[model samples]
Target: MPRSVLVTGGTSGIGRAVAERFTADGAGVVITGRREHLVESVAKELGAVGVVCDAADPRAVEALAARFDTLDVLVNAAGGLGAAQPGPEAAELEAVLAHWRADLDGNLLSAVLTTTALKPVLAPGGTALAVGTIGSERRGGSYGAAKAALAAWYAMLSAELGPRGVTANVIAPGYIAGTGFFQGAMTDVREQALIAETHTKRAGTPRDIAETVFFLASAGARHITGQTIHVDGGAFTTR
Candidate 1:
């Protein structure tokens, strides 16, 4: 029998790849994304169920939970860089605050809100993995701070859920190349500098994180919880 898994933000990059990986492994995968068309398209392509929901909205999250009765895995792959606020009446300080707020909501609260909504339906001894960034420990913009919050929240959740046989962990990635994650933000020097930091001298890929997630969710990782595993090609450990 295939285990039922839910992956949020499953239309792109890390989330899309994670969804595919689970499907390949014979899991009954359901994915969610904000874009209804893209979500539907990806679902059709991958043979997974896709729901349209914004993770930041409580109602939407609650609705998301209503879709599942029991979940074997919940991968919170819904995070990204926060940007400056958009407003004409906002002042300078408020604009700055907006940037942080955006990041926090995008990178941190998505997981929190989604997980909280799904708590009742999570299968016992289930596995959960959230995508984090090395930025939490280094120069990750305001987005990093949000990811840091995510890690801490997972620790709290793990403490509460551990006895129930549910495991939650974070996978912090570094320098993932070829994803819209960079979105052409990198100058040549910046890209090279990142590559230099990794002992492997190679950028990480979505598949790298996906494979690690597979392991962490497997029986072999049953003993592990409340942990952060770096998937950054030794960039974080060495640099």
Candidate 2:
């Protein structure tokens, strides 16, 4: 039987690419997106199952879990920068709290809730992959902070899942060009500077990350757990 894989936020960008890679590998892939129509369209186009779900929502995640009885891989790619929330200038404490909460909900909580809800369904020897960002390693604000927290949380998760034969890790990318990640925030000079920082002198592609995800889910990566694999072309290096 083909390995069953679940990719949340698989309708576009990196998530979509990861789903496609697994599908090509003959995995029984299921993709999820918050939007119904897009989920349906992408699923049909990719010849995989699609479910509409907000992975951050506990109830929705529970409902989503009911759709799959067993999963060999779970990719938590259902996170992105949401709308601009109240800035530091905002006076109301409630507004400030809500703003930060939204960031966590979108980026960190979504992965946590989804993983928690589906933890039981994850088969022995399965893998869990969470999408992260280089922003967390640098001057990450709210969104970055959330991604950083995600990486930290994964360490603990790995400790628990490792003995059970399930592996957990985070994939952080830097300045990927093909995705809508920049969201019109990137200018010509800024884009160039980002590219120049990389040893490869080019923005990373979704396929780059997709291939990494595919590798992590393979038997070769069984010894590699609780680690963050940066596919940023040497943009950020560790000594």
Candidate 3:
């Protein structure tokens, strides 16, 4: 039987690409997005089930778990940078705290809650892939910190889930272009700098991440659990 897969941020970019890849591989996929329209559109287009869910919300995550009959793979790709909270002009501490909290909710807790909810349904010998960022080591601020926390938690989670035959891994991506990741924040200098830092010297694409995820979820990679695979054209490693 084809495996049942879920990509939490399946409406766009890496999540969309990964969902497509799994669908093409003959798996049944369910993609979730906060937006019903986008989720429906992508689900219809890819021939996968679409569920509207907010991973940060415990109720939603539980509902998502209840919706699944059997889960073979769970890809937590719904994380992103939220608006930075305002801070005191004198301290700049509030903004930092707020941003970090949002990041925790968006990047860390979203996956944590969702995974906890779905842990029961996740089949033995399944894979759970969470999307992480290279910024945790780079110039990452609150965003990076939250992702760093996620990586840390996944280690323990992997140990706990291992005996159940469920593998939890992270895919740390570097400089993926056209993902709305830098939709409003991209600057000419930052763009040039990113390009110059890579060994491939080309921006990473969503498909690159999709392929890596595919490989990690494969039967051959069953032993590769609790690891973070970087798919950034050597940007995070060498740069």
Tens-digit lDDT track for model 2 on 1-239? 99999999999999999999999999999999989999999999998999999887888899999888898999999888765467676779867677788889999999999999888988988999999999999977888999999999999999999998999999999988878776878899999999999999998999999999999999999989999889899999986
Model 1: per-residue Cα lDDT over 58-174, one tens digit each: 999999998888999999998787756569998888888989888888878889999998988888879878999999999877888889989999999999889999999999999
RMSD of each: 1.5, 1.9, 2.1
Give the per-residue lDDT of model 3 (tens digit) for 1-239. 99999999999999999999999999999999999998898899999999999999988988889988779999999988876657457357766677778888989999999888888888997988899999888798878888988888888889989999989999999999889887588998998899888899999999999999999899899999888788888887742
Q: Please report the TM-score between candidate 1 and the true structure.
A: 0.96
Worst 10 residues of 2 by lDDT: 82-91
- For each candidate in the order shown, give its overall lDDT on alpha carbons: 0.89, 0.92, 0.89
Task: List the candidates' TM-scores in order.
Answer: 0.96, 0.95, 0.94
Query: What value of lDDT does candidate 3 attain over all alpha carbons?
Result: 0.89
Query: On TM-score, who's better, 1 or 3?
Result: 1
Q: List the residue pairs that clash in candidate 3.
A: 125-165
lDDT of 1 at 168: 91
Q: Deviation in angstroms for 66 in model 3?
A: 0.5
